[model samples]
Target: MLTLHPNSNQDVVDQSLPVNFQDFIKSEFHDMKQDLTSISKDITSLRQELQDIRIAMGFINDEHNKINEKIAKMESKFKAFDALVTTVEHLRTVNEKLEADCNAKDQWARRSNIEICGIPEKKGENLLRITEEIAKKAGFDLKMTEIDFVTRVSSTNKVNKPKPIVVRLQSRYRKDDFLACLRKLKVICQDLGFAKNESRIYFNDHLTKFNKMLLQRAKVLAKERTYKYVWVRNCTIMVRQNDTSPVIHIANVDDLKKIK
Candidate 1:
């Protein structure tokens, strides 16, 4: 057994303790450095992602502005189109009124004329002689010079029938008087030396092509509604339900609705 001093034992313990503490401090410092490096790398990645998000937001904002501009342009075009449509409709109404006025003037020009229907046509027949014969049968004192002209006109109907005689008198008053006499006499084809044909002759105011069509429509509608009178006066279509009923002037196809 060896004897040892207390001071020497204390000095040895102090030297070993210093070496252990130093090693522990070095290990903790190295671990701290590694943690700081990892935190720095993570911060750098987060910054890059934030920058990318900002760039994407800028692109989206630009697209939104472009869409707004396109919508504004479309709205303007639609407004312009609506205005154009209104203008066209107004023009159409004006054009229709002008055409109606022109037609009225044309019809008024033929006021002094008379249309004779149900008269049999013959080759080389004298129209003036036939007209004079009609006046004689009706007991009307009509002179040959009172007639300005007489001619056969083509029928507007599709059926193959005798052409009607159109007579333009020198005076409208004379034409009216002659028509009234013929109506009162109720002259027929047989009275005019057509012994085989007995169809009653018809005397009417000479109407334009348009007025003739309108008159036909008025006659059909009046008959359907049990109207007693449908006739043309001075090229104007007239309709009456009865003797006491108010007369209706039919100016166009739309007037047909007035019957009911």
Candidate 2:
């Protein structure tokens, strides 16, 4: 119902609506599409992170299982080691006990005072018996006696008492026979520190040296008035290896004997 000019009517119509409405709608759509795309990307990232977390968890679980298995094995090995240690301790204790028992037995044997022969008759009978036993063990038998005499002085201070005769047994038999006896006696006497040169005296030269040394010591010891000089004589002779031989005096104490 309105009459208007054509240009003014167009201008009025344009002014009635918003400007660039289609472009605004297109821009809004573009922004919304971009937002949706970003959201999708975020969701994909979140999913990948979750997957990584799950994989990591699986790996951690596998590692934990392996660790547990290793711990179990270690515990088993420790127990085995402990058992082995216990066994070794037990063995050591047993060995120590056995050794102690053996030592006790050996000590008892060494300390036992069991006599090998009958009671002795003379003052030096025990010494003779001991010597005899030692000799027998070493495959020899010889008589041993003390030499020299003791002379007591009289109360008057004028004359000394007559010294009693003292005799010492010298090996009267052949050097081989006496040498064997001497060697055996030396071995038995070695432990007691009675003499040191017994083992080294083998030949005639060694025996002569040993005898000279012995005589020197003996002379020094005979300074007592009661004892002047030691007289040694070989009393009896019997083959040690053959017990069936008759016992006889082979020589005197000073190696002077008839080898009949």
Candidate 3:
């Protein structure tokens, strides 16, 4: 049984109010602490995710740098390769020019010689006497002293033909005059006492192997194009459409384009 006055009741009510307020403060503090702990967990998870992203970015950057390095190396190699190709082309051009010069000099050395073809080869043939007989038939006064030497050379092809005779003359003028006279006469084997053979004797300027090949090419091209003439003079390859046309000189393989 509790007895209270009106002021005493007010004092009890005031004391109970403090206890309720303390309980309310404690509950709010607990809720706030839980919220702070949840926030800390969320921050830790974000930090780990950020660390993963940083690692990924670092790997990508390193790979990008490596790719750049490889690209730079490839560019350098390409430049060096281009330079090497240019040098090789220059050397090739120089070598071809030198070879042409050497071939020209070789042909110049053989200027005073004549090549005779289609003459039957006799086992005990006196080439000089044969030459003299041919000159006599052509009505040319070819003294024995004017001749330097005469020899039979093997044919360049595998065909079964007699070896040709190459005659060196002491004077290019004499050789030219003899060739002119022989061409005009159009002599044959029969003229040289080979009664059974009727093959025409052919006389020509002595040419280097290079010029000979060039002449053959020019002849074939001329025949294909219906050109009237392809002749060699002084080791030069000449082409003509006809007697009235201007002559074209062929100096190299590149000149084949001029045929058209």
Candidate 4:
């Protein structure tokens, strides 16, 4: 039995105890089963989401690998192209050097040779006899035995365009003496009863095709740049700015800048 005061603040309450132990255990077990069911559903959903994430990661990794492969191939191709370009450049440089050396050797072969131009050609004309005649006329006192080789050079058979005579002297002394006699050609023409300017004979060192082009180019540059003289000496193209200017030996076309 209980007694309550009139001003006491109280609420309804259940003061009961478990009277059936087996029934309570069954109820508790049922609640736990429900909770476990919900947890199982959540765990299944989590596994699905993890699978999706794994698939996405695999796709990204595959794409990354493909991109890397492409980049590697491009790098390989670039290296090959670079190597090819380097080889071509090297071959071109070597070829140019060989050509320059060949031209130099060819010029050296013609070092002791001289050429006579403006001399008219005739049938059965003896070149050695004519050389002696010209030398004697120029007061050179030259002999026929001083000549090593003599020939007329003509690329075409046109008789009006007479070819020059090429002469290889037996000695450098004769070569110098031959050139000196050529300088006095005006005297030779006087002795031969020809006009001063009518001799029409010119003497020069025999030059290779390359050196000839070099001389031609140097002459053009000298004229265009107003140089005083452009001449060939010992198969070399020479340029001078004035009478007393230092002689510039033109070894190649690049040397044209000296006159320019």
Candidate 2: 10-residue stretch with minimal lDDT:
112-121
Per-residue lDDT for 1-260 in model 3, tens only?
A: 12235755221222345676756665766787789899999999999999999999999999999999999999999999999999999999999999889888888888888889999888889999999998998899999999999998877955678888989899988888988887777878887888988998998888878788888898999999989989877657899988898889988877877787
Q: Largest TM-score belongs to which candidate? A: 3
Q: lDDT per residue, candidate 4, 23-112, as tens digits?
A: 565566678878989999999999999999999999999999999999999999999999999999999989988988999998877777
Q: What TM-score does model 4 achieve against the real structure?
A: 0.65
Q: Residue 120, candidate 3: how far off, in angstroms?
A: 2.5
State, as a TM-score between 0 and 1, how close model 1 is to the true structure: 0.69
* lDDT comparison, 3 vs 4, better candidate: 3
Where does model 1 exceed 4 Å of error? 1-77
Higher-TM-score candidate of 2 and 3 = 3
How many backbone clashes does every candidate have? 0, 10, 0, 0
**Candidate 1 lDDT tens digits, 1-260:** 12235756311222344676756655665687678788888889889988988998898889889988988998898899899999889998888788678778877777778889988888899999999998898899999989999998888765656788988889988888888787777878888888988898888888878778888888888899999999876677889999999999998778889998
Query: What is the RMSD of candidate 1?
Result: 9.9
* Global lDDT scores for all candidate models: 0.83, 0.42, 0.85, 0.77
lDDT of 1 at 221: 86
Residue 105 error, candidate 4, Å: 2.1
- Per-residue lDDT of 63-154 in model 2, one digit per residue for the tens? 99999999999999999999999999999989877865764454333221111111112332334444445545556544444211111112
TM-score of each: 0.69, 0.38, 0.76, 0.65
What's the lDDT of the predicted structure labeled candidate 1?
0.83
User: Relative to the unseen true structure, what is the C-alpha lDDT of residue 66 in candidate 3, on a scale of 0 to 100?
Assistant: 100
- Most lDDT-accurate candidate: 3
